[model samples]
Target: MSQPIALSSEVPATCRACNVRHAGMCAVLTAAELATMARSARRTQHAPGEPLVVEDSKLTSYANVTDGVVKLSRVLRNGRQQVVGLQFAPDLLGRLFGRENLVNVEAASEVDLCRIPKDVLEQLVATNPVLKQRLLDQSLQDLDEARDWMVTLGRKDARQRVASLLLLVARRCGAPGIDDPDRVVFDLPLTRSDMADFLGLTIETVSRQISRLRHEGVVQVANHRHVVIPSLPRLETLAG
Candidate 1:
């Protein structure tokens, strides 16, 4: 394939100041490439529960989540939505090379994103083999997580499942979850009802397990959403 037209412009200040630019999809880009991308890039923020992409909708833009949680789900024929995946900062938010969205994506918390036009991303992916490879790498990582979750949902008991869910958030946690190496803290992205839906457990069961964890000193909760894990080791033990 022929090389892309060389650019000589400086990257935008917004791109330079971005928190996730160094770790996100644009990380693999050349300085000129970044300048090209920034020419059309726009920063966007979303409130909790705001929809980013809807199932079966035509694709127009892609985003790199800067800070916050995104929930990806799909609607069944019965119009019920199934929670399929969650995305965090630095994760690319849209599927590449797709015409229409396959899932409904929403903000699980207040979100910040860098939106890149669809054509811009597609052009980059075409001429940049590294970008394509990185997309594949991310997809494989997602597939691995899904397989692991299958085991969690199928084999793990209610308590273990709850612990596993907590661990999942804690592992990818930012801000509060970033400071302590041994401790993990973050707001619960999913509510009890949402948690029940994701975990394939009843609301009462999830509530009971969380209360049990609190009683056992495995975790601390406040405002019904805030979670503080004093010991990662202890939480991992419970997840098993």
Candidate 2:
């Protein structure tokens, strides 16, 4: 507790899991079981724009974010890309099931993560019913998010998409609901380009849409970070 944690360029062969921030995922571990997990985790860092995993890369480990943001994107053969997901603080990274990578992972900002060997996690899950149940619950939540994103990508227009994304960020940051009947200011954590990708719009289009919102008195965009929703219900309807 006396020293600051350092990020590593690569996962050290011998690392301790006691350093992880979100060890509650392993809360059911017995003292001995916890010690085993601690021995298998390594701290790693990725600088902004660095690739953590590319399409089709072999999956060898799972990770939990300690700091910054990471993006999960898919690149098409024609060089187009879509950001499918973004990981913020305490979010998990990497796919399980030993499949080759289905998306590319990159640090959207300078990032820190706790890298856990897949084998260790699997062993823990096999012997520990509580850990297994926790993983399943987390997986179910992720599946729900995937379904929502599918709707965003397949059905929602740009305006709706942006609205939905903003709603999501607001909720993640502690907004009760899209329509809480209360006016409040929430800050946007993503860049223009990141917002565009998440909403499937060009940067210019995103800029224009935001301007339109401001002009319409629907929202107030100040200093490129804060969003003041004048009418939460109206914003929710427009976001659809």
Candidate 3:
């Protein structure tokens, strides 16, 4: 059960200024539709490790991430757990029209969410064909990404897997206006252990592969969580 914290009373202006507004769920909405959504929407913040939606629980709300990352995962009956996916800013959270959550969603870093009531979202989706199509498109994209990750885990070697993860994170989180495509800098949203979970490797193995990449000049580690890629093409070569 997640609760919304009201950050502002004016939602339309806030939505207009949002960095992801044009690209996120709000993009398909008209001004009037957006205004209607604003009435039931509020902003909420979650700290790292806070659970946004728990597995098997009833969902009460829907959200769009305005900032930070979220990790989607599931646990087995025997207590084994794996990181299934990572959701970046502008990604939608919560299953629309679903009765319960199948995976646990947690903040990988400090996160801000535009929280909308479940009933309001359902109503909007019911009446808006464009909104429905956008949601369908998002679902298909997610399916494709999941399949690609499955291939990475099933066939790619440890080094390739690590490199692929780096490229994925950089594309998702890197700052804009770097004149060169060869260089990229971004922070690792997940810890080493969490990386292991996501990559289907052990903590020790993840650390070793990261060290190997550093020594081979594939990447420069500014710190434990910060990574710099000197050549994007070089990294992609290693990923394959």
1-240 in candidate 3: lDDT tens per residue? 222322334347878677677776787777777788878899888999998888999888889999999999999888988999998988889888998888999999999999998999999899878788888888898899899999999999999999989888888887633788778888888999999999999999999999999999999897698788888889888998
Kindly give the stretch of ten consecutive residues in candidate 1 with the minimal lDDT sum.
Answer: 1-10
Model 1 gets an lDDT of 0.86
Backbone clashes in model 1, listed as residue pairs:
none
Off by over 4 Å in 2: 1-24, 27-31, 174-189, 216-223, 226-237
lDDT of each: 0.86, 0.72, 0.86
Per-model RMSD to reference: 3.2, 7.1, 5.3
TM-score of each predicted structure versus truth: 0.91, 0.76, 0.91
lDDT of 3 at 41: 92
Give the better candidate number (2 or 3) by TM-score: 3
Per-residue lDDT of model 1, residues 1-240, tens digit only? 433432334556777788876675767777777888888988899999898998989989988889999999988899877888899988887778878888899999999998989999899989899888878888898899999999999999999999999999988873344666787778988878778878999999999999999999999999999998999888999898
